[model samples]
Target chain A: MAMSQATAAGPRRNRVLNGILVNGTLALICLLWLVPLLGLLVSSFRERSDITTSGWWTVFPHKSYISAKQDQLTKGLALDKPIQVEGVSLTDDQLRAGYTLPDGRKLIWANRRARIVDVQTSQWTTKANFTTANYQAVVLGQTYTYKQSDGSTKTEVGEDMSKAFINSLTVAIPATVIPILLAAFAAYAFAWMRFPGRRPLFAMVVGLLVVPSQVALIPLLRAFSNLHVNGTYLSLWLVHTGFGLSLAIYLLYNYISGLPREILESAFIDGASPFTIFLRLILPLSVPALASFAIFQFMWVWNDYLYALIFLGSTPDTQVLTIKLANLIGSRGQDWHLLTAGAFISMILPLVVFFSLQRYFVRGLLAGSVKG
Target chain B: MIHQTRDAENKRASSAATSGWIPGQFFAGLLGVVVVIALLWAGFIYLRAARSASILNAIVAIIWGVGGIGALFYVSNTLIEALPQKSRDRIRPFLFFGPGVVILFLFLTIPTLITLYQSFFNNDTTRFVGLSNYIATFTDRSMLESFRNNLIWLFLGTGFCVSFGLLIAVLADRSKFESLAKAIIFMPMAISLVGASVIWRFMYAYAPADQPQIGVLNAVLTSLGLQPQSWLTLQPWNNLFLVAVLIWGSTGFAMVLFSAALKGVPGDLLEAARVDGATEVQTFFAIIIPYIQGTILTVTTTTAIGTLKIFDQVFVMTGGQYGTEVVGTEFYRQFFTNRNFGYGAAIAIVLFIAISPVLVYNLRQLQKQEGF
Candidate 1:
């Protein structure tokens, strides 16, 4: 280990500085990673109006309010002497600026000359208010209600992105589940099952790994359309499955094959059928491999736009998260806050999934796939 | 001990194994009858033959859907019996591999044969165009450009991802803070491609003439008194920028693989080098590199293959805009978007052909390592 360390780099002090540089670089990276996420969380709290006008970070300590002069209608507290209104005591110029109104009237732009009236109060007192409306707009609410920076009340139509969020789930979960289930079984066959032409069959699948799925999209779509499966969750789910199965099976095969042969033999001798061995013995032992591949396939399909796009279309109801983000940009004209917020919204689930499952990655997938 | 266990298991195994093929037993006798009936159906279609294409398409579907399933099972079970007695005990495992074979054939092999046929046809899908499709792809400016850019993708994209990933993995190994640093670097891997594209879109964001650049990188450049640049829209450079995203995403994969390989390097080898009074840098070049050479080669090959077929990032980021077309992205654009089946097939062939060298090398290396 020490020899490997020496050849790889210098001693501890040198490594320490290298470590500092790496961590510093990573810290900057973390900040970079967090910006979009931070923007989302901040955007969730901010009013649509504020989001459009200022960056999310500008929200705190910036003190945004419309200020105006409110004439104390009763002659502005006339003193006992009732001094003549010399120079219009406390003239409009002296009325001071920046005030909020108790009536919830926001001052767009104010000048001292404006005065309060029964029907119209131009005199705006500084009003600083915060509400949970933005949160409602994002989670379990609407996309259109979010205000634009250019002071436009933008409204989204037809299927809400949130519905597509569920639609994405409908596509993603099945696309993920079906392939892993199939692959786990296939991987077992490739790994432990004694079969004629096993190598060729496994090779065919692995060789397909290099055969890009982009090649199959059109024909598959045509086939699906002919089968009346086009534009259905079933279509995209199958597309993901067909595309994912090769790699997933290969990866799982490696992990399963790497397991000690004795356990499997023991199971076989106990009269446990193949299915029984897989269910009771192999499956539990292969948890780490399964988790890693699950993370992999989940992330891949969840972020996938092409398969979903080609098979599912731009139909708002069937759009996956990727398509939704694409539309948000194309239609909304780069509403940064909303895009950031929406981008982060789509990512939260994947992040949690990857972070939680990443620990299992230590098992060395490639180890089994290749020989020592 | 083994013999005693084997007899106990045989009683349990025989029943379970036979039960698994019970459906096959049921179908075995009926298959002959069904084939005769199916021929009659085909003959009926042949006689009506006015709608031959529709019938032909249906026949294709049935062959793929039904015959494909049957073929897979028959092939799988037939092969199962051919293994030596030592390996024959793996019957229970073969059952799981059944579905993977079916999906692989249905999706990959059949489609490949179809693509070969399609490459000979015209855009309308009715006329055979011979070698003209492949010829036009070579002569056409856009197709040629996509090929050139894909080479750039293969060389530079995979090149950076492997080198940088190896650099990071080597540095992070044997460190106190290894896991945390790796986690942060791997964070991008967790994000969906869309989310990463969105995050990067902000980082590479360009606004019209006078707008303040919101992308962090551009923001920094402007802050540094340099003019803001449109990173993604820059013709040649945009390809590299897109590649950067791939590097960020795939480096963790390379890192983890190399890291695992690093673990397998024995410590005594390194200690011997140290006792020889080898300098730190000398030790790395002399000892570590050679020890982990197999893994480095594997990582490089895997990453190279990955880059050869990259589509998602480019498709999402720029849709192959600004002369940044790659084979994977261009194949989709040609076949599906433009409805040009011949050109798409030609490009797909090119990609498959291009990846063959690396594939062969990887296979050979994998075989040599595995002693298969």
Candidate 2:
């Protein structure tokens, strides 16, 4: 009895150790994956000055020790009154103009709070730093007043992303819906209907699956220009539909063909015409497949950058979020405040759809990739 | 027996057909075609006119683009039903499949052929320049750099994604928090490459050595008593940094696929190995890896294709500067910025040729599975 109990205890201990190892590894990887996104999320909510001055992880409430010169201390502060630093009283105007400290460290005021700086470092504690201003600036235009070298104030307006958000929706909806609709019909034909060259045609689609879109870029650009449809939403919608058709058809075909043969045979025996049977029976029965393809197409079209960039162009009137965000990275490379918010805005919709209908999305992925 | 049943169904379909309405049905079909064309044209015009960013314009475009296509399919199907049985049978499949096929031919196949033909022409396409563009693609200095960088991205990016993905998937499979862990890792797949660049841009943000390092990476380096590095501008190694962004964004895709493939490994098989005194590591390498070998290939090729066409991350992060140039960016620069049509077309064709082996492999796999 003791021998059996010892053997059982050994395997149990092994199982416990195995569980810890598995969970520990997954937790580490999960943390690694989450940190970058978490940093971006945190930075998006931070004030512009804070983003430029410190790492996003610093936004966590903590005590910071840092040495700063008087000029460096005055940069982000908006002082309202005179303050005494190491027995020297300094007014707001004096601080703004320039103040020199004997030891290059002094008391500084920011956001109506004062902290002492030492020759080595200063002790400053902060609550969790947070702000919604970055999002406001990215979604709604923010105006900045800068004093130029000539002492003239210049007001520059930041780019508003609300319009680009709308443009992305405009591009994604049709680009998603049209291809699925067209591919559903084609997939049905490929699955159930007998036609000449159907086998070869279906094979051709599978071949087209790996044809990189780069090959079509130049000629299509020329064609669009000649057709006077360059930089239009219609052009993007058409191009996306064409590019997305093969996979849409392939995934839908896999599901539609696997549907029980009895149902189709019974509908035929009942003398229902092919089109009616398709409309009344096949389509309704194929909802799960249709839904999987819909989610796939929607996400693909929403997250598309290359096609949208090349086909739609980056004009303010037509650019999608990907194009707009990419442009922000180019023109405002240093504007992390705008970029973090813009990037979040661009991903929010797809993220929402992905989380909500993730089962269908996963189903689509498995169907597309693991046929065997 | 199947052929006889099909013949009987055909006879029944013919008997149910309404005769003596040929001209009316023909005109009705013509009218349906015209209506579809007109509706599509109107939607296109409205979409083009709504270049201004407004919620109202977005709503209108969605309705017209989506609703208009829906109406076209409905009308075409109805008109086809009105035709006599002989014509209907001959035309029904086309009615379902025509639009998708036409779009594919116009947007993908024909344009790819045009790009191939244009590759033989001069920059302006006014003269034949046979093989020069191809030679330049091979011999050009910048092109060679792009090829080398692309090779780096292809191997490193695909390798990291697949291995990390396989690791995460395998570990998560045995955890109680499987869904949540998988969800967090999979979340990045929903983000666009542009958004991912922005996210990592914050992670890799750098400051001068004198100032506090704002980027997390540099901040960690400084805290560890190391000199901060400019991750993006640090040549040669910068390509790896950019490739890291791709891996971060795509590993989730590989993981989901691997996770699904892992589930397909029979529980009993794993149990048998464990009972046979095999260690987990031994079982993983001996049993699990071989079981999922096909999925590994699929994930590798898929990720490789994506890396080969690496554009958005490189464009947004480094703009292909600091020796991080790849074929996708090179194609964009030659085609759009430089207006080197022949050269750009050659680059695109080169990309297509590079992908053909994988394409052929996928086709062969599909043929073996479906017995085509």
lDDT of 2 by residue, A1-372 (tens): 999998999889989999998998889889988999998888888876677777878766565545454322444344566655556878765544345567645444322244323323445556366878777788887864444445587666767999899888888877777777778788888888777877778877888888999999898889888877878787887788889898988988898888899998997786766766677777898888888888888888888888888888899877999999999988998888788988999999999999999999999888987772
lDDT of 2 at B251: 91
On DockQ, the candidate that comes out on top is 2
The DockQ-based CAPRI class assigned to model 1 is: acceptable
Candidate 2: which pairs clash? Answer: none
Per-residue lDDT for B279 in model 2? 95
Total clashes for model 1: 16
DockQ for every prediction shown: 0.25, 0.55
Give the Cα-based TM-score of candidate 2 against the true structure.
0.88
Calculate the i-RMS of every candidate, to one decimal place: 8.2, 2.9
Q: For residues A1-372, write the lDDT of model 1, one tens digit per residue.
A: 988987767567776886787666655654654565455556555565655444445544544443333322433433333222212233332233322246654332122223331212443232234455543444555544655554577675322457667766766765666676678778887777667778777767767776767567657777887876777665775678788888888788878888998988877667654655665677799888887777667777877777877888777656777888877666763665466667767878878877777765434345333332
State which candidate has the highest lDDT: 2
